[model samples]
Each structure stands twice: as structure tokens, then as C-alpha cells.
Target: MDTIASLFSFITWPVSWVIVQFHKLYGAIFGPDTGWAWGLSIVSLVVLIRICLIPLFVKQIKATRNMQALQPKMKAIQERYKSDKQRQSEEMMKLYKETGTNPLSSCLPILAQSPFFFALYHVLSKIASGDKIGALNQQLVDSAREAHIFGAPIAAKFMDTPEKVEALNASLTDVRIVTAVMIVLMSASQFFTQRQLMMKNVDLTVKTPYMQQQKMLMYIFPVIFAVMGINFPVGVLVYWLTTNVWTMGQQMYVINQNPTPGSKAQDAYLQRLLKSVTQHGEVRGRGRKRVVKDIVAKGSDRNENERRFFAGLAKAGFAAQADGTVVKSDTVSAEAEGGAGTRRQQPKRQTKAQRQAAAAQQAKEAEDATLSVEATPEDKPAPSLEKGPKPQAKGAKPGAQDAADKPARPSRANSGGARQGKSGQRKGPQRPKHPSSKK
Candidate 1:
């Protein structure tokens, strides 16, 4: 670590100078020899460096956007010169030049901070060594060495020997504990930042190896940081932890304000913007108006979130215009075409003869079903519809014939003896008469 830090000694003066200035301000509130003064000085330095790198960060965002915009052309170039690597490279360079995009811009912030980062590491190492370096003279180095953060000196490290820790007026236990906690915090912040970028700021509609690789890195990066953090001096850990926290916060702000297109964060941002627009009857900000114009230009190319935005506008009786304005139009928004891209299936057409045949078959099935139901046996037989003459008595009873019609005579059949009932069965108990019934 010392060897690596020493290689960046060219920037040691500036890095130490910044730390000293911050320390002066903090040393007034907290004692000059207190851990808070030295520790907060490192944190402030990180904030200062990040604030200076804002322009680079913005350029990185712009450069990434440009690259995304040029992807189609790049793909076409690749297809055209796929067999010729040299030609493909030439064409790619031409496109980049035409678009005035620097691919390396995305790495500018990290590259720019490298010198300062190592220089700080170098300064902290000097303090730990009890040696003077850059603006950290002997007195400053001594003060830094004596300053302990939670019983661990600012210059102490997790890997330092117990004897070395005691020499710096701290126990090995305190140094390891403090450094371990900082390492964990730094790693956690880095992981969270990566996770948010993957989950919310990236277009997740498509699955690809690159996305899988990023998901894997989301876990792998923290482990890398944790492994590297143990050797970092307490002051260096303070710098790394503060910068990690800063990066996480900055990423959160970007996700909330200006997320990538077609991303979940963009969806949430546009949702809130739409609510405000609907409530106010117009887009509230110039930035939002520009965003709306771009989405309108996308037309069918807009993402599902942008489609939903149009749906909300159309539902509220407002139509989006090409100029990024909403007008109260009765016509529905074309962008809000619910499943219009899909085709509805229609049934096959039938000929007149076929239709008639279907109807006849259906009628035949109905007739057959009716006959089946009617043929089923019932508990009681249906009343007979046919009429027949009544049985006449054997001897001149025929002339007396209409006995069935003689209302004044009591009919023996009505006496409830063995006789034909309405159901054609003997319904009453018949007394076997004394031998007279047989007669």
C-alpha cells in the first residue's frame, strides 16, 4: 500500500494542503488533536473533490446518452464490416467523431480522482510512519498520529501490529474494530448504489448477459471493497467511506430527477410529472416540457411508462401535442391505443347451405331429446284419452242399458268393493262375501 501511495507523490502537496485547510476550520470546533478534527477533515476533502468533479459527471451522463443514441448506426456499421475488424473500428471512430462523443468521458470522474486519492493515501501512510510528507510537516504528522478515532489513531490500520498500534497510542483491538466498521459501511454504500442503478436507473425490459453480469457485479463489488479496505489507513478509510456515501446520494438524486429513458426511475419521475401537469393544466417546468416533446417524438417507440403517461393525459380530456403542449381535444390520443397493435381473430365464414345443414342437425337433436324424455316411465300412468262403451249386463240389462247414466240408482262399483278404480286396479278392500260373492 505504501509503495502504491508513493507512486502518486506528485499530487501529495495539493491533497495534503486541502486536508490541512479543512482541518484548520474543523480544529477550531473540535480540538486540533481530536479524532473529529482529523476525521472530518478527510470527509470534507472528499466532498470538495466531488463538487469539483460535477462537470465531469454531467459530461459522462451526456456522453452515455449520445452513445445510446448512436447504437443503431454503430450496429449497422458492425454488420457492414463484421468480417473486417479494422474497417469496423474505422467506421466506429468516424461515427463517434461525427457525433462529437468521447467514450472515455464515462470514466473521467474516476480517472480524475485517482491522483488525489493516492496522494491522500500517501499522506496518511506518512502520518502512520511518523515521517513528514508534503504539507504534513513533523508537527502536523505528530498531531495526526496522536488523534484517535474511537481509541484508534487516524493513521492506524486494521493490519498494523499490536506493538505499532501501542506506539501510536491505540490498541490493536480498537484499530481493527474501527477499520472493520468503516470497511463494512463503505462496502455497503457501494453495493446499495450499484443495486439502485441496476434496479431503477437501467432499462430492464430486455434480458441480456450484460445485465446478468451487472447483477453479479452488484454482489462482487462489495466483497472486493471489503477485501481492499482492511489495508487502508483509518484516514484513507474515512475518505473512501465518505465518497461512497456521496456517490450513493448523488445517484439517488439522479434517479429521482433525470433517470435514463425507458427505466423504472423514469417511469416514476414521469408519473409524478403527469400528476402535476394534470393538476395544473400544463407542464410546470422547461425541463419537463422538453421531456414531453421527446416522448411525443418517440410515438410508438415510447416505453410502456411513456404510453401510460399519454393514457393519463387522454383520460383527462387532454391531448399531447408535438410541441410538448397539452390541449383540451375531444379526440382520443393516438398514443393511448389500447392493444391496437394486436389483431383480433375472426371466425371462419360459412356458406348458406352449410348454415342450413347446421340448423337441421340442431332441430333433429332437439326432436330426439324430446322423444327420449317422453318415453321415460312415470310413477303413474297418464289418463287414457280413448273412450269406450261400458260393459252391459248379460240378460236384458242392455235394454236397461244406461244404468251408468241412472243417477237415482246407487252404483255397486261405488260401494268400494272389488271394482275397477280410475287407475284400472282394485283400489278398495273387498270382503269375500259369505259364499254369495262367489255366486
Candidate 2:
């Protein structure tokens, strides 16, 4: 059993040795005696990783921008096959191919960072555990043991007993407090960094579902980190906090210097940054303070001009007031006068069928009227037996003739009048004129 245990330890020794080397590397670069050194190492790690992934970041930005630009075309394709699920899927794939934009581009930076993050975690954990001193060389192990910042040793166990604390090189209470503070700062800085990227750096026109997914992850990942932070060792917390601060600063620089135009947060961030830069120098010295005052004076003048322009527009009844209410003349001319309640009256509603029927009826009536107006008098039939009073038998009763004649009179008058006094009047025209004469 002892040999088996020794064998297992030997098998894991290389992994432990690598972690020790990483810790030593950090300690050497950032003085092993100070927490600030470790903090700086964390910052350095972040900077190095970010620099390495710069190409990936650029690709991601380009991909996102391309996706946004293709939104209109994609929407059109969606609309074209809204009811065809299979076709929509095929078309979407084709669109993606044509655009050469992958939805996964945004995650490339995170994917690249994951391995480095894991490595850092391992290094910090090993440093905090203080159990694998045999894996490290004598010089590294001695330096690590001497590593203290503000009287708190980096290798000190935060949950150590009172006796163990006294035995340790630094105050356990202070180490635990520092660890807790670092964890909180780590969580907070990560949240803010991610929040700014999501709210400020993203392009507004990207309607891809993946962009929304990325946004959700941006918020969710930070919250997850915050919740899991408590479990991390103080050394790990220090690294995480420093890394987060670097990320925040990096994001701030990117958003302020190269903001997406349609992003509200990006614009605001840029404006704020510009205001800061114009008024204050890189450092806030007394000279920069005076410069800021001058910038403020210029900003005030521009604001005054804008206010005056808006005021003029408002006075002319062409603009809304600051409260969003439009000002208009209240006086009504005779032509414009109406009942006060009339302005507020709701429009009458019509059902679809009713509206269609009304439209059809109107069209038919218009067509008939137009045909009548276009027809020449000669084209219309002259009054004949069809329209005139029927000829009565030689001894027909007057009552029968009167009843028959009454119905036919109006028709005869209309048709006869349509061809009155024409030189080429046909025999049919003469017959209708003689019928009324006979009566």
C-alpha cells in the first residue's frame, strides 16, 4: 500500500511541478514578498493573453459587423419563406456561407482565455495549498514561503487554527480578510467589465440569435464567477481580481476609442471619455483641471446654441417642448371651426366583408354611369314595340289599354328621346312616336 501510494504521487508529481514552476515564474517577475507583485503578475497575464488574442478579437468584431450588415438581406429571405420551415433553414445556411460570418466568432476570445485561466487557477491553488513544496526547487519554495504583502503571507491558510496562525509567518486574520476583499473585487470588476462589453461594445444592428445568446452569457458568466469566487483561495482571488481590473480597463479603452455608432452605451461611453480627455489630461493634475474648466465652458456654449435653436423652433410651433408636448395655436379660423367634441370623435369601423361589398357596389355603379355617358345617341335603340304601348285589338277595352299603356310610357319616352329628330331615324323610331299619338 505504501509503494502504491508512492507510485501514484510520482505519477502526479510532474503536474504539481509545472504548477510550482508557474508560481515561481510569477513570483520572480513580481516580487514574491509583496501582494502587489502577485497582483501585477495577474495583470501581466491578462495583458499577455489579450495581446495574443488580439487577432481573434479583431476577427470577432469584423464577423459581428458583417452579420449586422446582412440583417436586412436575412430578414428579406426570412419573409420570402416565412411559411416554409425547410426552405428557411436552407436559405439561412446559404446566407451564412455567403456572408462568411460565424455566430461562434464572439466566443473565440473566451475559448482562448479558458486554458490560461485554468493554468492560473492551478498555480494559485498550488501556492495557497503549500502542500507540494517538494515539487518546487529549494530556491522557489523558500521564496514562496517568504512571500508576504502587508504582513499577510500569500501561502498562509485562511481557515487555520489559532495555534497554526501564530506558527505561520503572517497574520491569518489579515490574510482571510484580504482574500475576502479580493474575491469581492474580482467578482465586481468582472461583472462591470462584462456588463460594459455587452451594453456598450456590441453592434446594435446584429439581429442574429447568437448575438443575444452571447449577451446572455456575458451577464450569466460574471454572475457565475461571483457566486463561485468564495470557494477560490485568497491567492486565486488576488489573481482573478487583478485580471478583472485589467479587463475592465481594456474594455473601457476599446469602447471609448472605437465605439459602434448605433450602440447607445458605446456612444455615451465615448462621449464621456472624450469629455474626460478634452477637459482633463491622461492624469488629473492642476493644469488638467484648468483645461477641463475650459472644455466645460465650450460645452456650455454649444448647449446654449442648441437650446436657442430649439427655443426658436418651439416658438414657431415646429418643435416639441422639453416635456415632449407640442405647442400650437389655439385660435380657430372660420374654415377650421368645428364642434369641440368632433376633434375627438372615433372613426367608424367596418368589417372586411362589408368594406369589400361597399367597394364592389360603388365600382359597379360608376361603371354603369360611365358607359351611359360614353354611349352615342345612335348606338342606343330607338323606341319600338319592345318599349312602346302594345297595339290594342280593334275593340279592346279602354281599361286594358290604359293599364298596358301606363307601364310602357316611361320606357318609350326614355328610348325615343335617345334618338329624337335624327335624319337617319329607322322605322323603329317612327313606330314608338306613333303609338303615343294613337292613344
- For this target, which candidate reaches the highest TM-score against the unseen true structure? 1
Clashes of 2: 0
The Cα RMSD in angstroms, rounded to one decimal, for candidate 1 relative to the true structure is 19.9
What tens-digit string does per-residue lDDT give for candidate 1 at 189-258? 9999989988998776654445676689899999998999998899889999998999899989989989
TM-score of each: 0.73, 0.49
Q: lDDT of model 1 at residue 315?
A: 73
lDDT of 2 by residue, 168-205 (tens): 56676787777667666776787787678777766654
Find the 10 residues in a row with the least total lDDT in model 1: 333-342
Deviation from native of the Cα of residue 244 in model 2, angstroms:
2.0
Question: Candidate 2: deviation at residue 113, Å?
Answer: 1.8
Give the CA lDDT, 0 to 100, for residue 422 in model 2: 63
